[model samples]
Target: MQTPSAADLLLAWERGLDQSPTRRALSLLEACLPGVTLDRLAALPIGMRDTQLLRLRESLFGNSVAAVSECPDCGERLDVAFNTNDVRHMSVEKIDAETMEPQTQAHQLHTGGYDITYRIPTSSDLLVISTADDIEPQLALLQRCLTEVQQNGIPVQANALPDSVIAAISKDMANADPQAQIELGLVCPECSYAWNALFDIAAFLWNEIHAWAKRMLHEVHTLARTYGWREADILAMSARRRQIYLELAQT
Candidate 1:
């Protein structure tokens, strides 16, 4: 069986983004895997996606990626080198199937002085959230996604819930699951300035793709110049043979 290539996974994600253009662009740049359904992609663990993207970038580009940042306090600029292999080796906790169900009842009960339940956001929940037009609707959708059941005797309705009730539910759900939150922290070594860094997966993946394309293009150019070969022919050469040709050309 042929293992799925990075390109194949990328294409699948692209095809899955029919409802939202923002999501489509995000998926392409993030290099998110194609789920069985569009909703499943949203609930996917962010760390898992980050790990996969890093591995894919390394396969296409090189191991080392330069990360540049500006210090928030002193306006000092710094460049940090990150190894894709190190990222690949980092441990990520996966959400189990037992906690995958939506928490509709819990949120409804929380409004009536009952305890609420919450679960990690899944790819599907993200899809629903992304489609929401306003903050209230978004909160409602989130509540519906996270609320598993209510400790109170009140019955939960998956549909026909009011906006205010949904907001309350979302708040209760968020309070229940601290682990669902994603954080990016950065500390400045010089000034001791601390800031929450924005780690955008889409932007990172796009940078990797652009870098890989440029490097491959450069290799193709070198091969064509040295051997008088067509671009297509050069690209078709095995990576090992290409390296050997490049070495021979230099000598």
Candidate 2:
């Protein structure tokens, strides 16, 4: 997929405002990756989906992803910066040629006297699970993703699995797909405490896109009022050109 132009990103940002984060992520990818169908993109594993977002994010913004979090112990806020490469788990070999999307391998585990076969959860699974009013979303997700299960050489019901077995499966899934959830080690200078901060790529990228789209809308309004330019014309201009025109309009 080619890099999204300024116009393309602006349109995506506008379209995503009314969408839930899951839907917004799909919209962003659809805008950037026209080659891949929406269904195929939705079927991609969460980690693979995130790998694509990280690529698009790097292209549109930059490699450095900056974030801030409050220290749970001391209540002090900490600034964190990391590169896209840090959390990316999909290697070049797993990328499919036709879709240009990362493909994840199926995993099997023998634990707690049960043989479990599963694949990494996909965006489709996430969308369904998130909409469910479950007390524990992870358990619900595991239930949906459990492709096959056998205990003591006999078929077993996935829902009837015990909490201990579920925990084991969850741990194994996390190890097998590291990129599905990213946790950063954070230190609080004031309290001398350290904690692992969970990072949500979908939320972070959507926040950034929302801010950018608002700023671009303001610029478009200014240019449109001053020079009678269409929104399309304003968005079509390169970022450099738009800034130059904004400066001229201000004068």
Candidate 3:
């Protein structure tokens, strides 16, 4: 079978925006089935899309990414090199089914505090959050989607649930997943300024996609120039063969 082209994979990724991240990632894999799927491209199990995009960026661009940052504490300008290869090659394990199943069970039990009642926010959940008019409504919606049972030990009807209940549910879900927790973790070197840094998956994914898109375009330019090929042709080249050609050209 003819391997699907990189362009094909990219197109698939683009089409996945309307879908949940998990669904989108799953779709990306299906589109490249029998050759390369999104699942195989991911280095970690239950991988964030941003992480997958980092892998794609490293595959297309050399390791070091020029990263620029401004310190909120000291107002100091910081410019440093970020290693894409390190980011891409970072070890990750798949969330075991047993572990995931328990989370579901915990959601059902509602025995834990508000923190333990919510499910992990999925791609689908994010979509609902995005459409909410404000943070309160968004949080309410997230809780509504995640809350499996009410405090009264009754299964909540999703559409009929009260906003207050939804808010409580959201708080509960947030407590359940430490990995999903966002907290501040920065200490300013100069002024010793401390601030909270929110680690949000949505924001991370956006930045990753932005970086990957730029890197892929760069690869298109390089391969097109070296081989006198069209963008489509260059993208079609396997990473191995492309590297071999680059080596031969240098020689």
Q: Considering every candidate listed, which one attains the maximal lDDT?
A: 2
Report per-prediction Cα RMSD to one decimal: 6.7, 1.8, 7.0
In candidate 3, what are the lDDT values of residues 6-27, reduced to their tens digit?
Answer: 6765676577667655455545
lDDT of 1 by residue, 1-251 (tens): 12234344435354634535436433552333333233444445444444444545556556876777788799877665666553343333443333322322222345545444555444455556666776555654556564554435564554545666666765654444422332345678789788865544445656555565566678878888888999767766677888899989889
By descending TM-score, how would the candidates be arranged? 2, 1, 3
Per-residue CA lDDT of candidate 2, range 1-251, in tens?
56787788877887888887888998899888988988888888777778778878888888999999999998998889898888777543276856856656668999888999987888888788888995478877877888889988888877788989999998988877777788998899889899899998888988998898889899999999999999898888888999999999999
Residue 234 local lDDT, model 1: 72
- Local accuracy by lDDT, each model: 0.53, 0.84, 0.50
State which candidate has the highest TM-score. 2
lDDT of 1 at 97: 32
Which residue segments of model 2 deviate by more than 4 Å? 90-93, 101-103, 134-136
| lDDT (Cα) of model 2 | 0.84
**Alpha-carbon TM-score of each model against the true structure:** 0.56, 0.93, 0.53
TM-score, cand. 2 vs. native: 0.93
Ranking 2 against 3 by TM-score, winner: 2
